[model samples]
Target: MKQARSFDELRALSGNWLSREALPAWIENGYDQRLELFHERLSFSAQPLSDLPRRLMVQCRQLYVLAQLTCRGMRDDRALIAQTWESVKRYFYRPALSHRWAFSIDPDGDVADPRCDTYTLAFLLFTLAWLYRVQPNQDYLDRVDEVLTLLDGPLAASSHGLIDAVPRPDGFLRQNPHMHLLEAFLELHESTGRADYLDRACALHALFSSRMLWRAQEALPELHDDDWQPARPDDNWYEPGHHFEWVWLLRRLSKATGIDVDQDVRLLLSRAIAEGIDAEGFAIERVGIHNQSAWNSRRLWGTCEYLKACAAEAEAAPSESEAWRSRANSALAAIHDHFLQTAYHGLWNDRLDADGSRLSADVPASSLYHLVLAIMECERVFGRVVPPSRPEPGRMRALFLDRDGVINVDTGYPRKPADITFVEGAMEAIQQAQTYGYRVVVVSNQSAIARAYATEAEVMQLHSWMAKQLEAQGAVVDAWYHCPFHHEAQNPVYLHPDHFDRKPNPGMILRAAQDLNIDLTRSQMIGDNPSDVEAARRAGVSGHLFTGGNLALFAREVLMPRPISEASK
Candidate 1:
C-alpha cells in the first residue's frame, strides 16, 4: 500500500494552495470592490454576493484571514491589511453608541444591527490581535483596551463571564460566543505574552470548564440559560467541530500556562473522533446532546478542525503521534477530495449532505480562516510541507528479530512444530511494532539442518506452521530468514568452513534488506546474544539486547515514546 504524505508534506502542500491559489483568489474576488468589505458568501459562479448585509464577524475574520498569510510569510500584504483595517474602522467601529462596534451593516453602509453580539466582539478582538502582531500600532492597542473595558463593564455576564450579547434575547444564551472569546483571549495571550491576556483566558476557560464543557454528555452543550446553566437535554445540541477546535485551543492554553490539560484534551478528542467523524471521514455539523445522535449536515471547516485537533494531540503526546497523525492525514485527504476543489479554482464548497452532495452552493468566506489555521498549525508542529513524491518502498523500516530467543523460548534448536513455545509478550511486541510503523522480520540461525537433527525441509515446514499460528494470534511476521549452512555439519550438503549467513556477520540482514526492500539505517535488531549486536553493526542498524522480560515492554522502551512535557513550549 502507498504511504500517505507526512505531516510536513501536508503543510507544504496546503500552504501552496493557501498562498498561490486560495488567498489570492479571495483577495481579487472575495472582497467587495465597491464596498471594500469582505462579502459573506460567494456564489458557485465565483461572484461575490454583495446585496447581503455585511457582518462584523465576516470583516474581522477576513482581516485575520488576510493577515495570517502575511504573518506566515506566504504573502506580504501589509498595505492591504492596513487598507482593510481602515474599512473596518469606517464600517464596523461605532463612535456614536458608546464606542461599541456595530453587529452588522446594511448594503448602504448604515448600521443594520446595533446590538453588538459576543461572537462579533470576540472576532473583532481576534482581528486586533493579529493586527498588532503584523504591526503593533498604538491605535490597535488602544482599541483592544477600549473593547475590554466595554466587555467588563456593560456586556459582562450576571456573575463573571460576558453576556451572550447586548439586548439579551429571551432565548437561551450560547456557549459558542464564549468559545470564540476564549479563542480570542488565547490569540491575544500568545501575541503579547501579557499576564492580563492570560488572566482573561483563565476566566473564560474556568467558565467553560464549569458550564459548557459537559463531561457527562461527552460533548459541550451549545445552549445555556442566562445564568450559565446548560439548556434542557431535549433542546440542547452540540457541534462536533467545536469539540475538535477546543482540542487545539486547550493545547495552546496549556503552552501559555504550566497547567496540565492532557486528560481533558484526550477525553474531548476521543469522544469527537468516535462520535463526531462519520464513516466517510467528514465531521458532522451537529449532534443531539441528549440522544447522542448526529445531523447529516457536514461543513468543510469541521474537517479542518479535526485536522487541527489531531495535529495538536500529536504534538502534545509524541508516543501516540502515529494514531493522531494518521487521523490528521485522513482529514487532509478528505479536505483535498471534497472541500479544496471547486468549479472555480481556489474556491470551496462549504457544506455537504449525507451522500456528499453540495448542501450549500454559496461559500462562506469565514471558513477560509479555519482551513488556513489548520495548515498553519500543521506547519508549526511538523514543519512546512514541500513538494510531495511517492514514498520509496525501500525506505521503510523494520524490526529485525532473532527467532529462537526473541520470538519463542530457546529450546536448543528443537525443530519440531510441537516443540515450539512462543515467548510471553512476543506476539504483542510484533503488533506494537507494526502500530508504530515497523515491519516485523524474523531471522533465525537454524543450524539444526547442518547438525542432521532435522532435515532442511522439516525446519522450513516448522517455520511456515509457526507463521500461521502467529498470524492467527494477530502477530504477523512480514518476512523470515534462516541459515541452514553451518561450520560443523553432519549433513554434507550443509557443511561449510564459515557460512556468511551465520550470526556475527551482516549477511542475513543484508539479504533481508535486498529481498524485502528494507531501509537498514532506520531498521532495528533485537536478539539475546552479542553476536546479534555485532551483526547489526556490520549491517548498519541499531541493535538492542533483549533480556529476560516481557518482549513488548523491552521493545517499547527501545522505540522511545518520549513524553512531550515541553512540546507546547
Candidate 2:
C-alpha cells in the first residue's frame, strides 16, 4: 500500500486543484452566460441540462459562491453577479406573495414551484449576507427584514420558534432547514453585527443541542417531530453529513458566544469519522446509531462537510492538529479521486454508490456552495490563497525582523517593558521601509516562557509597550509572531523537539505570510541569529545578517536598485 499524504499536503493539493481546475471549469460549464444564471445541473461532459428547472435555492447558492470568490480575490465577475441579482429579483420574487421568492422557475421565465419554504429563504438570507459584505446595500438589508417578518407572521406555526412552509405544512419537520437558518443568521450577524441575528442563532443552537441531538447515542437525526424531538428511533436513521456540519456550526457558535463546547465537538467528530466514513473514504449518506449503514449513497456535500469539520477540529485541538489534518487530507483525496472528473475539469460526481461507482451524472449548482466553503476552509488552515492571484497579485512585500536582536537591544530574554531599547536608527529604518511599500513584521523566538524566566502575558505586554514606543516614532509593525517553545525545557507543557513554529522551522514566517498576504519571494528576514536565517531560507525568503550598524543605512542598501537575493549574495 502507498503511504498517505499529510493534511497540510492534502490541503495544498486539493486547494490548488479547486482554484486552478475546478473553479474555471464551473465558470465554463456550470454557469450559463446567456441565461445569466447557473444551470440546474451539468452532464458529465460539462453540458448543461436545460430541461431541469432553475431552483431559487440553487441561484442563491451560486451567487453566494461567486460573491465569496470575489471577496477572496479569486474571481472578478461583478458584472455577472450584478446581472444574476437582477435576474433573481425580476423573475423569482413575487410582489403578490409579499416579496417572497418562488422556489424554482423554468428557463422560460415561468414559476415552477411558487411555495416559499424556509429552506430556500434561508439560503436567500445567506446569499444576501454575502452580497452585503461584498457590496453593502440597504436593499439587501431590507429584503432580509422582509423575509424575517414573513417567516415570523404568516409562515410561523402557533408554536414559537417553529416555521412551517408557506401555503401548507410539509407534514415533516426537518432539522435541515433549521441548520441553514442558523447558518444564515450567523452570516447576517457577522455582516451587520446585529445582536438580534446572533440571538436568533443562539435559540436555534440551543434547540439543536437540547432536542435535535439524540442524547443516548449522541447522533443528530435527519427528521424531527413538530416539537423538535427526533422523529425516528435511535437506531433508525442518522446523517453523517449533518454530524460534520453540526461540528463546524457548533464550533462557530462556541467561538461567537465564548461558551466551551469542546467536548461535544470532539464527540460528534469522533462518532462521525468512526461510523460515517466507508472503507472507500467517502462520507456515507446515512448511518444508524450503532454505526450500521442505512443508506449507502455518498454525496459531494457530505465530504465537504467532513473536510470542514476536520479543519475546525485541527484548529481547536493543537495536540491532535496533525491527526485532524490527516483525516482532512484523506477526505480531500477521496473527493479528488472519486467526485472530480478528469474530462470535465470543474464538474463533480455529486452522488456515488457504495462500491465507489458514479450514481449521479449531473453536477448540481447547490454543491458549488459546499465546495467553495470547503476550499475556503482549506486555504484558511494551510495559509494559502485559493485560486492563486494572477496579473500582479495584491500580496504585500514584508520585512521580517527578529525582536530581541534586530529591533530592541538584546539583554538576554528581556521580558520587562522597561527593559526595551531600540537599536541604532531602528525607528527610522522601519519608517523608511514602510514608505517603500514593505510591511514590517516582527517574528521572535521567546524560549523564556518555556524556561520559566517570563510568562507569555509579560512578553505580549512588552511587545505592546514596544509598539507604543514605535508609534511615537511614526513607524508601526504590521504583525507580531512568536514561538514560546523549547525542545529541552523544564516545563513539560512547553517541551517539544523540532517544533515547527519555533525559529529555524519557518512556521512563524509561513503563517505571517499567509495571514498578511505577504509574498515570500519578495520578502526578507533580518536577524542577528543563524536560526532566523535558516527560517528565512525554509520560508523561501532572503535573509540579511544585522551586525552593529545604523539600521537606516542597511535598509537603504537592502532596498536599493537590485533584487534582495542578488544584493544579499
**Predicted model with the maximum TM-score:** 2
Q: If scored against the real structure, what TM-score would every candidate get?
A: 0.66, 0.70
Model 2 TM-score relative to the real fold:
0.70
Error of 2 at 70 (Å): 0.9
Q: How do the residues 402-426 of candidate 2 rate in per-residue lDDT, one tens digit apiece?
A: 8887888889999887787789989
Model 1, global lDDT:
0.77
Candidate 1 residue 333 C-alpha distance from true site, Å: 0.7
Whole-structure CA lDDT of model 2: 0.77
Per-residue accuracy of model 1 over 428-512 as CA lDDT, tens digit each: 8899888888877887788887788986557756777888888788877876777676779886556665555678777667656
Model 1: what TM-score?
0.66
When summed lDDT is taken over every stretch of 10 residues in candidate 2, the lowest stretch is 384-393
